[model samples]
Target: MRLAIFLLIFCIFEYALTVDQTNFKTCDQSSFCRRCRKVKPDNPKFALVPGTLNIYSDSITADLIHKDNKHLFSLKLEALEQSNTFRLLVDEKTPLKPRYKVQDALKSAPKPGSIKVHEGDTEFTITSGPNKAVVTADPFRVDFYQNDILTVSVNAKGLMTFEHLRPKPQQPADGENAENPAANDVKEADEIDDPGAWEENFKSHHDSKPYGPEAIALDFSFPEAEVLFGIPEHADSFALKSTSGTDPYRLYNVDVFEYIIDSKMALYGSVPVIYGHGGGTIVPKKERIRRAATLMKNDPYTLVVCLNSAGKAEGTIYLDDEKSYNYRKGEYNYINMKFENNVLDVNFIGKPNFKTAAWIERVVIAGLGRIPKSATLIIDGASQELEILPHGEGVAVRKPGISVQQIYNIRLNF
Candidate 1:
């Protein structure tokens, strides 16, 4: 009778809860993301005057202009040791202190191959070779090629900008300060050249931009491809949409409540990943893995992103001619998220949740018997079931109605 009663109770609780709108966040909650998104065209932040590109032994660097502004700036075009990807990064490596890197939430990064640049096309180049292809430093743009065919391109619209890093000047201190009484007044501002460059206000929020403005923007185009995806944390479609009539894809991460789907708003976690599928029809018997889904969507995939700091990013993908099946995410043209733009501007941590790490950290408490180690507990499935994870060794029983409908995270603390 006791067992039956217990069984009756546990069934009432299950896991499989559908994600809703309130479970994520927005731009206002994130400090740095908000700061970067507020960047305007004439803010002197886009004042990037072209500087000379200096070629290093295996790398390159340049002195970028702050565009008649007040921020210190530099640009780096470096080569990686094993990574096949070329890096274009602009950031304040050394600031008033240290900035943050939010790269961990991302799954992985792609390695670019040794590339070749040829100038026979528009602000782009064609890259092709054995087991690899690329377009390095094309004039005004960069392009990727696959098996002697051009695939993806960046800066096609020439819409690229990098926000520089600058320190907030100290406030005037003490009563017996300076000879110029006008200079003794404290000034905090946001808009460059505006006296309010040291600080900024948005709604009820005020940001102390100690390491002022460091946002980066770039334009990417996929001429023969469509159905671009990634830049998650939104309640939108897996296939991204055009930002022409709306706000540009928001990248800020926040703690949002139950979220609505098909919207380009910011949410809890973000994956700065993208996948481009070719749009044209393939000849019969020809392999169409990379460009297959794009053809189905009847549109090409174009993507845009912003990066800053020790991290780097490359935007081009080419598939080999081989017919091997490397279909990712259970389908052709699907991509596993590979994040390289590590820009976690916040240093905040979440409360202790063992379920988040339970798969890897298999440590259990001692001094407890039947519930101690290596035992199987049957959990009833709601609509479906998943036993991907198994407890090491413990024998325990709980209220009878155990179900997967509401069991993604269970906390059994001692």
Candidate 2:
């Protein structure tokens, strides 16, 4: 009986590997995506109306209209003062009902900066320092430029779509009149045909779509980027690949079980952030060393600083001392670090009324090239030039007074 049960379980596991994935919707299956992809660059339906621009102290607002439907949309462009990042938002000017907007995700409201809007015959440009956003009137497109280099663009390939809310058509009962004359007349007046506008279904699940189709999609193009990363929380590679033949990178959060790898299928968590880098200019081979700084705070705090010799400089610092009883009682200590020109300086500051035996047990500084024959370590007011021991492609520097409760300055020079 035991042998039979074991073989049955193994067979079931093997069969589960080839389970059907028809429950997931493809781009063509989605009504909004299908309609958006059909819009050509040369013949777009949406256009920015002239003389509707409103320039404020920190943002630029305008109204865009659909040529065919005559629907109006509000467009706002703001430049973040703190980070110099630009944000472009588009929504219905006056939606019939309030549409769902994502909230509680941002750490806090962004600080806005002054932006000057330059109006021209063909386009309106918003300039803030070295970053500029050019809003083209016809065909409705926005391009972001950093230091005169085009970094990102929206609707560059003309895949923008905004499904407006409308009244759901009432279905006639069996044996009753198929359609009313007035309703048919209105349907013929509007050329757009939305088959699954009122409701959508996949497998055994049905989406009632109470507020109608309100899906918004826009294509973002990065012209001067070679590699893109982030948007993780997936069991995939760090470097994101192209989604040419497969589905686009999905951000919808789902509880996936035994999710597939190397696909755009969203897993446990979803964050709508992506980082792009590695473009333009090459540095000298000898001066290509990369450096990184990280801070880890917990019951026990730790800081990691390293330089990349062979690969990119990266490390994870775990803090296990932040949960101590003294910390909860309002006692705090800090470690300040500064790195300049092949030298690392660290200063430990302790609280006046709090005295706890806390110390950094291990400090690993990797990518030191070769173990130096001798190095200098200055602790407190004393200096000692000691022979350094070789670590894995680096050197290990240890201090005896790191655990004591006193202010000290430790400087390491290679």
Instruction: Kindly list the per-residue Cα lDDT of model 1 for residues 290-407, writing each as its tens digit.
Output: 5565443222222222121212222322322124453332222211111132211111121211111111112121112224222222223223221222223322222222211112
Give the Å shift of residue 192 in candidate 1.
Answer: 2.8
Give lDDT tens digits, candidate 2, residues 1-414: 999999999999877874245766887677766555565664666788888988898898889887777889999899888536688898999988878788988758888887888889999888888789999988899999865667788888776778787766666567455555454445432344666656777778788887677767777787765668778476678678887656666676766576766666767778888765433211111112235222222112232345432222222221224456665554654434544344555544444444555454334455455554555656667776644556665565543335433444334553
What's the lDDT for residue 104 in model 2? 85
lDDT of each: 0.41, 0.63
lDDT of 2 at 136: 93
Steric collisions counted per model = 51, 7
TM-score of each: 0.44, 0.63
lDDT of 2 at 258: 60
